[model samples]
Target: MPSDYHHGVRVIEILDGVRPIRTVETGVVGVVGTAPDADPEVFPLDEAVLIIGSRTKAAKLDTTGNGQGTLPGVMDAIFDQIAPLIVVVRVEDVEDENEQISKILGTVDATGHHSGLQALLTAKTSLGIKPRILGAPGFSHHQPVADELGIKAEHLRAFAYVDSPATTVEEAVVHRNLFGNKRVMIMWPAFKVWDTPLADYVYQPASARALGMRAKLDNDIGWHKTISNIVINGVSGLTADVSWELQNPVTDAGYLNANEITTMVVQDGFRFWGSRTCSGDPMFAFESAVRTGDVLADTIGEAHMWAVDKPMSPTLIQNIMDGVNSKFRELKNFSYIVNAECYLDPELNSVESLASGKLWLNYDYSPVPPLEQLGFRAKLTNKYLVELLEVK
Candidate 1:
């Protein structure tokens, strides 16, 4: 049947133009450690990688009898503080430190199969998700793993949380100075945390706790804030409390802070008391600055993926510049940056270069630096009454 429609009816429509940039997920942690159920026959050790969303999922995969090389503790420590997604890469458990290191850095077999760290790297590539933070809490105080993870982080444009094999402040500072890289941050002195299933306090790496704290900071606030002076949850006490005042000089804490090695101290409760990267370059020494720069770079890179292989016209270039400048202005409005400038010049985008299908973009910005030092000044005055009476 046919019917006549009502006259003078109005219809409204909306259109979306110029796609905005997408914000990348921050503080996703990638953990490589040992798990009993990660056997070759059960979970295919060569390709053993899982994304755990909650503590319950982690408990199911933790088949270790004594809860060693298990993910429940780390998961509990992380999820108890902040809710961030985690990727778990399980490697075979070995007693010998050298053998474990060897396994993590896998070698190609006759059948062209890789194991251990190599396998995890392969899985990471295949999964197509890059975690912004990396940690390996199961391998306590293992420097080799930290080194390899630092290399991976440099390639992946991420950050790593490394644990120093030192129990005292002096030893930790010495150990931290051995490696100088911007992508890694060193933590010291394992802490004892109560385990419900074990009914006892077990010492665990401080890197796990640091990772959780960073995650919480990212969730609660922006990445421009430092992770220092924040209380660490899920821990009772440090294995050895390193005092900043008892050192050779009272200023040794400043030295430790300069070296990028953070320590646990007793305040009202245990707290993380430093924020710096292991980079020798003083420009990027602060961990918060490094993270903010990374976030900016990643966001810009992902946002420009749509312009690839497009026509190299002036309109196209202007569109790209406008999009980038818009994002930076938003950051400035949010107080993440002092100001940002982006442009392309003839020197960078020459006629020959443009003809050869090449384009260049240059941007500069300053991040909000953390207040590592605070000072207060006071002056004594004797004529307070006379000064007050003369104001009118």
Candidate 2:
């Protein structure tokens, strides 16, 4: 429903390149119809099919030597029952009409739902009728049009952007209230987390157990358990973990038996959040895709323990940190966050103008000092320094 056409295309492309992805079909399919005469259903559906058939047959003399095919009569009955999915656009509004159609098709591309239609069209093209294209999300009126064209409606996978309807005014109000002009990036992992020293040190036992259960479900349902990452631009971003509870009562009941077991699992959820500001840059328009790619790269790097098999060159990280800090300062508004321990590193301290009033987190690690605790110091991490001309 939302503009997801490009994303769907990307998904299919990536999966096709990597491996043969198997997916179970879910939900209902959409219908289609096409017509040249005035139709009622086409009034609402802009992306509906419009088939312009010819009625005049070619002369026998023309066909005798040229092998010309006879033209078939155009049927007016095609418009009778097939609703307004295929509207007769006036020649005058061709530009506006095409723009709307393009937008819908673009949405389909963004969401990765165009594969079925693409396949259908490919098949139809092989038979000689120049394949007419449809948008990713199928509307109710389009079913008959598809039928008239002899294209199977089942080839379409109908999926709306927002599935759940708002039941209460409060829910709607809350949803609207939280909306803002910002960008968001959502991420899903590619592999499951089994064992890692970082998990042992950073996460609690309860957290580890929850991850284990998730991995198990991923295995059962044939979904990958790898953790994903995301990065958002055009708006300041915030990160948080989210989850949703889903269960099937019938399958859940079977768990009570000794031999039968069931686990009511919660699906992990992630959402990129930003305000909806019209003035935001084009990056905001592509925040979802950009962030997804960034996060995926980050997740892969993180999983590899930052080693990445590359030589232990700190140059890239150092350069990124330096560049980000420099840009933050140049912006003259946003505050820069820095880890103080990084400053003490011999490589960073020597750079001229590097130590300016940027915030820092204090950390100390030394084998010689036995009594002094070595970690982030409250003096640095907890305090902020106004930007001054000098580092001190």
Candidate 3:
């Protein structure tokens, strides 16, 4: 505080205005599942344990050859795509299959302990990172579990990848009807990979592969980029033979994508073919769009901690506005947003609200959506030949 009673010559550096906001990583995956053979000391029941770019101890996550647990194989699948931070919440692997579903769904005990999907809520507080990408791998195929995942994703400003039954394309469409949420994307069939532990080929859930793909896209590329069309590695084949045609929409791959169920396709090798979420709303159809919005909102919101409880002044208000606009430009340069503008509206910030030290800053941004379709009319005409004849 500068007072009138300040004696001689003293300098007060006024620090108020736009400061670059900290950008949170958008690729941290929080997965919930069983790890029957995992060291209980390492991955306690219902505790959020962080694993960063290492699998020395991850081997302990399962030793029974992926027989009882889900997390072991899923972790391997995610690591196959890209090494990103993973927050695992392990639950008890019970005898009853239905009990395993309940465990994966998790519960907040009366003592305030979080388990299952609920354990992800404490990821930020306990592990200093929030998982913006989430999944349950084997368990997410269960409708209730997937719905619960959607609920948790909304709370954490995260996105969830859910698996679908591999029975048929129609079954995948029916699975899509089981859930509809912008935060949740449904993946169909499963990916087959060589399981050295079992000396046989086993299927991994599409949701688990999606988790890895998303992490790679966010880390290697910008978060605004789409997860589709990228070549998937460490996969031999898909459990279902998803047909795909470059210029046709009447294929199995196209049908699954049309119904908002993401399926893999074989191109040069195998590629993730779909970009749509389970959302019925066209506005949030694409996972890339949802993620772009999440990153912007989370980064901007977390960056404003310095402004809290500070004296509101014109300089401070201007600083806030400029900070947001500047961030928009930076993100636009990185292809995170198409374009963005920030402004203060008098209608939103009323005189009374300002008097009460509340000011409303408004900004709008358009996310870069995935290119699902591209078309150029192939007109067979003499027009091009006429030009060629003149040149000759």
TM-score of each: 0.87, 0.17, 0.96
Model 2 residue 235 CA deviation in Å: 26
Candidate 1 per-residue C-alpha lDDT over 1-392 given as tens digits, one digit per residue, 9 for 90 to 100: 12456567656563223558876777677777766653344344546355545655666556554566645577778876776767666677788989987766566689867575545455456666666777777663677777877886776677888888876778888888778889888887788899876899988888887777887887788777777888888889878856664333345455667667877777677878788889989888888778878888999998987888877777788888888889988988988777887898778877888889999999988988888777678889786867767865
Q: lDDT of each prediction vs. the true structure?
A: 0.74, 0.23, 0.86
* Alpha-carbon RMSD, each predicted model: 6.0, 27.0, 1.8
Error of 1 at 198 (Å): 2.2
Local error of candidate 3 at residue 52 (angstroms)? 0.9
As a TM-score, model 1 comes out at 0.87
Lowest summed lDDT window (length 10), candidate 3: 59-68
Best by TM-score: 3
Model 1 CA lDDT for position 4:
55
Model 2 Cα lDDT, one tens digit per residue, 1-392? 34555544433332111111112211111222122232234222223233332211111112223211110000111111111111121111123544433322222456443322333333233322222112221111122222222222223211111101122323322332222222211111111222221232221111112122222222332122111211111111111122222222232212211111111122232212121111135443232222222222332223333323334235644433443334323322311111112132455344453434222222321111111112554454523444554576
Q: Of the candidates numbered 1 and 2, which has the greater lDDT value?
A: 1
lDDT of 3 by residue, 67-101 (tens): 45888888888898988899999999898988989
